[model samples]
Target: MVVTVFEAYAGLARRVLARPAWLGRTRLVAVDGPSGAGKTVFAARLADALARLGSGRPPVVNTDDLLDGWDDQLTFWPRLEESVLTPLRAGRAGAYHRYSWVRRRFLPRPVPVPAAPVLILEGVSVARAAVGPELSLAVFVTAPAALRLTRAVARDGPSILPELRRWHDGERAHFAADDTEARADLLVDGAPTLPHDPDRYYQRIARHPRPA
Candidate 1:
C-alpha cells in the first residue's frame, strides 16, 4: 500500500478542504519540520494539489524570510504575528518585509500576504503555540538526522554546518518545550517526498531569491 505523491497530495488536499476554516478568511496550513526535511517541496506540491482542485494557488510564506539571520531563529515570531498572521486573521491583506541574507538587512519593501482561502506556511517553528490555534491543518515533517544534515550541508555548504548544527540544537529545545510534533494533525515521512526530482526543493532555498 504505497501512496504515490499525487495520492498523498490528494489526501492532503481533501483534508484541507474538508476542515472548517480556522483562520478568519483562510484555512492556514502549517508545514513544520527540521531543516532539510522537505517542508518547502511538500508545501509547494500541496499548494499545487489544492489549486488543481480549484482551491486557487495558495501563497507560501517561509519562516526563512522572517528571520533576521542565522542567529535570529524563532525570535522573529512577534513580527510575523503582527505583520502577517494578525492581518490574515482579520481577513485583510497581511504584510511583512523579507530579510535579505545577501544584503544583511531586511528589504525595505513589504511583501503582500493576501487574505486567501488557504495559505501554506512552511518552516521551523511555524506551528508553535502562537500560531497553532489559527491553523486548520498542522503537518510535521521529519527525516533521519544524518540524511537531514547531509542534505542541509549539500544545500547550505559545509562551511555553515556548525551553524546549522547549532540551529538544530536550538530547534530541538524549542520543539521539546512546544511539543510541536505531538500537536501535528499529520506527521509526514519526508524521506519519500519529491523522490524523483530533488532540485525543486533546493531551488527556492539554494538560489536565495528575493522574498516575495
Candidate 2:
C-alpha cells in the first residue's frame, strides 16, 4: 500500500506562526504520541516540510540517543535539557550524542543543533516527558490500539509483542491524569486513521491552536 503524507509549506508556515505572541524564530516542534504511532517517520517528513516552509532550516533531534541504558530508562530527560534545550533557548548552536543500542555505548559524534527558526524533536515524549517550554508547537500522534499493536509487533518482532503491550498500558495510564493529549496543539492519526475526505488517507496534521 502507498503511504499517504501531507506537506503544505504555505499553510503549515502560517499555522505555525500563529500570533504576535510567538515567532518562527527559535521554534521547537515536538512530535509526541504513543509507541508504534510512527513518530520517527513523521518527524523526518515534518522536518523536511518545515525546512522547505520556514526561513531558517531547523535541525532534528531524536531523544533515543539521550536515553540511559535500557536499565535506567528515561534518566536521560535531564540530559536533554542540559544538552539540547539550554542551547536552543540561548539561541546558540547545541551539540549532543546519540546512544548506540547496537554498540551498547554512546557514539562520540555530536549532533550540532542550530538555533534555526524551528527545531524538530521527534520521539515518544519529545514534549510529554521532557522539558521544552520553547516548544512553539506540540503534536500528538494517535492510532487505534489494534493497529498500533500490529505495527509494533511487525516492526519490533513478535517476541516483543508482550513487552510493547505492557509499555502501551503504562503510557496510557501515565497520560490519563497528565492530559498531555488533552492539551495538544495538534493530533495526528498514525495507523488506520481517517479524514473528513473519506477517500483521503493523509490529512493535514490537525490544527488546534494553544492559548499561549
Candidate 3:
C-alpha cells in the first residue's frame, strides 16, 4: 500500500513541480484526506516529484505546523485567514511562525514561504475547508477503514489505536458531509501495494475541468 501510495502521490507532485516557477504567481495545491489516509506522506512525496519534474525547488507549507492547537483541532480556518490565506491573496508569500501545539503557542521565528508557482498544503481538511477557489488542484485521498487503521497502528503504535480510530471515523464523516470526495480534483487509494506514481496522477488533474 505504501508503495502504491508513494507512486500515485509522486505522480501528482511531478505535475505540480513541472509547472514554471514564477515567483510572481502563487499557486496553492491542497491534499486532503481522512485522519489515517496518509496525506502527509503523499504531500512530501509529491513535493519531491514536482521538484524532480521541474528541475527546481518545491516549497511546502503543512497545515499541521500552522494549526492553532488540539483545542481548536481541525479548525484551521481562522489562522489560515490571518496567515497563509491573506498573504497568498495579496500575491505575497505567506509567512508565519509555526505553531507548537505542545507549547500552546506559535514559535517566535517566522517561516517564509515563497510566492512561487506552486505551494503544497497537505492535511486533513486543507482542500475542502481552507483557501477559497484559487487552487491549482484539490486532491482527496481515500482508503478502507480497516486498511487505514492498520497503517495508523503501524505508524503510531498500538497504544494510539482507540484514539486514532475515533479520529478516522470523525474525518471520514466530515468529508462525506462536506461531499469532498465527489468534489475532489484527484483521488488516490491508500490500500494497494503498487506504487502510485505522480506524473500520471497529476496529468489527470491537469485535464480535469473546473468544478461547475
Candidate 4:
C-alpha cells in the first residue's frame, strides 16, 4: 500500500534502527541517485524522519560538497573514505573540508560529523559496491533523463547545460558499471507521476525483495 512520505521514511527508520551498526557505531544510510533526481531533498526528509524515530538528528554528508570540481566526480571517494568513512568505521568522529564550487577550492574550515546512531550519505554513486557491506539502507532515487536535465538546469542555471550534459554521460557509464539500482534496498521515484503531497509524501517505486 502507498504511504505518506513520513510514514514510509519512518518505517525505514525503524528497520534501520533494528539492524546492527555496520559503519562502526552508526547506521549508514546511503541515498544515491543521478544528478537533479531529488536525492538531496529526499535525504533531508529521511533524516528528519530518522530523527523523529531515533535519538537526535542524524548527520547528513552530501558527497557533492566534497568534490574538488567538475572533473573530480567519482574520484573524490578517496578523500571521503579517508576523512569520513575510515574514521567513522573506527568509531571516531569524522570531519572533511567542503569544496566551494564558486571559489574552485576546498574550504579552509572542516565540517564535523559526530558519531551518531544514524548517518545519511547522499549523492550519486555513494552506494557503490564497496559500500554495500557497510550500508544499513541503500536508496536509489531516479527520474526520466529529460526531466532530470530540466530540473538540473533550473537549479544550477542554464549556463551549466554543457557541463551537465557531460555529467549525465558520466553518470550513465558509472551507474551501468556499478549496477547501483539493482543493488538498492529501496527504489524511489524522484519525479513521481502519482498524486501526493510533495512535501509530506514521496512515491516509492519498489522495495527490493530479500533473499529467502
Best by lDDT: 4
The per-prediction tally of clashing pairs is 0, 1, 14, 1
Report residue 165 deviation for candidate 3 (angstroms): 4.0
Candidate 3 deviant stretches above 4 angstroms? 1-24, 101-104, 129-132, 158-162, 195-212
Taking the tens digit of each residue's C-alpha lDDT, what string does model 2 give over 112-196? 8776767777766666734435567777878777888888787768986665667777668667755767667767666534444
Instruction: Please list all clashing residue pairs in model 2, or write none if there are none.
Output: 65-99
lDDT of 1 at 97: 94
* Ordered list by TM-score, greatest first: 4, 1, 2, 3
Model 1 off-target regions past 4 Å? 1-7, 193-212
CA lDDT of every candidate: 0.83, 0.66, 0.67, 0.88
**Tens-digit lDDT track of model 1 for 1-212:** 22323235766688898888888979999999899988998899888888888868988999999999998898988888899888887889998999998898999999998898998999999999877778999988888899999999998789997889899999999999999988887777778635444422222111123557
Per-residue lDDT tens digits for candidate 3, residues 1-212, read 12222334455565665554332366678788876676776677677766766545657777778767544446766776677667766688777789885687999998987666688878787777435366777788777777778887887689876666667666777787778776777776644444444434422222245557
Question: What TM-score would every model get versus the actual structure?
Answer: 0.86, 0.78, 0.75, 0.92
Best by TM-score: 4
Give the root-mean-square deviation of each candidate in angstroms. 8.5, 5.8, 5.6, 3.3
